[model samples]
Target chain A: MQIDHSENIVELKNISFAYGGKNVLEDITFNVHKGDYLGIVGPNGGGKTTLLKIIIGLLTPSHGTVHLFGQDICCFNKWSKIGYVPQKATNFDNSFPLTVEEVVTMGRYGKPKNDKIVLQSLKQVEMLEFRNKLIGDLSGGQQQRVFIAKALAGEPEIIFLDEPTVGVDLKTQEQFYRILKDLNKKLKLTLVLISHDIDVIASETTEIACVNKKLIYDNNPENFLRSEKLKKLYGSGVKFVFHTH
Target chain B: MEAVLSLFFIHTNMFDIFQYGFILRGLEAGLIIAVIAPLIGIFLVLRRYSLIADTLSHVSLAGIALGLLLKINPIITALIASISSSIFIEKLRINKKVYGESALSIFLSGSLAIAIVLIGIAKGFNINLFNYLFGSIVTVKQIDVYLIGILGMVVIGLIIFFYKELVYVTFDEESAKVSGINTNFINTLLIVLAALTVSLAIPIVGILLVSALIVLPVVTALQFKKSFKQTILIAEVISIVSVFLGIFVSYYLNLATGGTIVLIALGIFFLSLFF
Candidate 1:
């Protein structure tokens, strides 16, 4: 990993949050550097999404400080600089009536219409051909790509994707990852993905962390599976089944 | 020919209510609805809060009942109470421990109870029922015109200034907030706009047709367009034409004004559905 003494892309410290009087995240601390593909994995309700929200300045933790681009999040004014592809969050209405081009163009909401940005982002995800197709008419995977294109409209340096592959076919998931990999390599954009698929994370991400309430950073997946910490996380019966080197 | 001619030369020669003032007032109110309804409708429809639109209008029924029971302006009371109810919905949405639909249903039924109670106690409602259930163009005075005009400007101004935020929050709220779109403020502002638009429109289209005005045009517009600007613009144009044509036809045919407008809008929406 190239360690540049430059800006910390995302930083959260001692973050604490709760929903329904139950602790969702307690003492969550992590830092994501520029060009880091940090994949977060944890069981259901383990605060993976909550952590992403904190980093993106979406939800304010009960107690914590979040810094984006090395500035205090509360005071940071550069919002258009971040691209976020929230979980497909859209239902298949079949009649939604919006074309892929229009959906992708939504990413440039606050910025000047950058055709180049739109085209490049689509090409990065290899969805340029379907830019004119209606979103409701696309397959689950293709629709996900349009959404990814929408998030990339502003050409943000850091991208946060919260479960981008949720509820899609396995082939589509692989295709989505291929697009993501191309973008990460070509643009050098810092990618933070929240996922439960450890296999995908193992193959794709340079930095992988196991998060549940608190975050342990730089814990090599190899080292993690060997240790007893993961068994406790996934329960005694569940063990990490490694799929790749 | 006579109507259009009379519109241009009415005040100088004619002295009847049909002169320009009545038609102008109706046209003005319709114009305001044309602008406000589609935007609010987009949010309401996206959030599956179309029922809230129904609930709000029903609640506005009680509000209008309060105004009528007190022998005052119903639109104003509706504006007040409907906005309050919308805010209440937002507050409940955040509580997270409670169900949102339950909040909407409780408020809806509670407002219905108030409306029924008020009607029972108000001594037969005095034939002014159409003003609440089916709006009249005649009830729109000069003051109502100015009120609609001003609120229309404020709603449009706020929407124009916050277009991106509104769109972001509407489609993907979590991403919107993550990208720093101030979802709370935007959500409240949207509900407030929805309440205000519904309240103001209730006076012209009545509660039943008001949600139609807010939704159908946008639904029609969505059939072809994708960008918010294009979608809203087409819906506005359709609304303007529908309102204008509906008023002329209603006035000439002696039919109900609000019903005529909504029916015409429905016709346009149906036309958009064909190949």
Candidate 2:
């Protein structure tokens, strides 16, 4: 599962963002090396989602530069190489009429339609059996997996997921992380996952980047747990809940 | 045996109705709109922007007034007005300051006021305006049929061409944008197509009830909960049947054409609830 760290997949330099004249992210700098499983952990209103949006060109930074796959993001048009799974709460209308297979097929938009790719993507997440089922009929965890299959259908080299496990049950969350880890190791796909669950992210991700309107820490997850920065960032109220499994 | 014979004459009389040129043209236009309305409606309803159809239909009223004032074809003027106002409404919504509903409300009331003022200035066109407001399908001219056919094809063609993009954008705008789809352009294109639909439908469905034709069938189809393609097909069927029934019933009963069509659609919607 080892991947070369010689090349950076995403490079953010002095990224700063503001909303209504108030700063949300200030002078943030980081790099996501190739095939790296980067987890971004921050408290509510800490600009985690905004940071992700800037990297994916959903929101332009007030002042900074972003490079994706070595190309400046402003000129970057190869979006097929990047996949995004947004927060499930805001992803779709519950009343929308679309099958699981149809939702995944949207990933192949602008390209020739390929049923094999859609099926393969669904099988990757073990959701092939539900391809014909309505997307709205699925449970929260099942919906998340279908979204993952959607991202995979694009054959993306890197995928950014925002709060993907929110509202998912604990058992399903564990299974979801396992599936994500398997995707990273087996497929060598780069991942940038945002979560508030510190313990699970620290256990699962190869690298951890802490943000509190600043890049407080960006290094190995193990080192992050051992450092005093986690306590300083979240105050003394944060408690570590270890999971046996 | 007598009942069977009477039913045969009734069926023959129904076909014989088309021998009248105006009736034929009215049905022709209604059927075209029946296909076009739900094609645009499915996307609009999914995004909860169904009110935009209402807003644009009212805006077309102002366009019609201007057309009457200038002594030009109101459909052409209404098309210009609705399309331009659609762009304006979309721009206002995208600015993020004005809420989507607020933008629609502003256009709805603002356009209605303008239409009333123009109607007052254009005096002596009350009869024409009444026809436009309530829809006089029997008065649908040959030129209107030609215009509806050509422009209706354009709208349907564009919707089909961007079918995948439209579905993706309507389902999740953010993801579609991340995946390299130009969501803003697709959104504007959708409303403009809606404007085209609303304007073209004016001669048959009238201004006030145009949104019903666009919205009712889709809402009824949504009850089926089928896949996207199947749902659109169901909506089309509902729309076509409603239009056919409305025309036939109104022709015999001497009812308002627009009200008749919408009532039929509403009846179908209520009937779909039981299924």
Write model 1 residue lDDT over B180-199, tens digit each, in one string.
Answer: 67789999998888888888
Off by over 4 Å in 2: A89-91, B1-12
List the lowest-lDDT window of 10 residues for candidate 2 chain B: B1-10
The best candidate in terms of DockQ: 2
Scored against the true structure, residue B75 in model 1 reaches a CA lDDT of: 82
Compared with the true structure, model 2 gives a TM-score of 0.96
Per-residue CA lDDT of model 2 for A153-176, tens digit only, reads: 999999999999988999999889
Q: Candidate 2, which CAPRI tier?
A: medium
What tens digits encode model 1's per-residue C-alpha lDDT throughout A1-85?
4546255888888899998799998887878878788899888889898888877777788998998887998888788789887
Candidate 2 per-residue C-alpha lDDT over B55-103 given as tens digits, one digit per residue, 9 for 90 to 100: 9999999999999999889999999999999998889888877998998
Off by over 4 Å in 1: A1-7, A62-65, A74-76, A90-94, A109-113, A213-215, A222-229, A236-245, B1-20, B69-71, B96-98, B223-227
True contacts kept of each: 0.50, 0.81
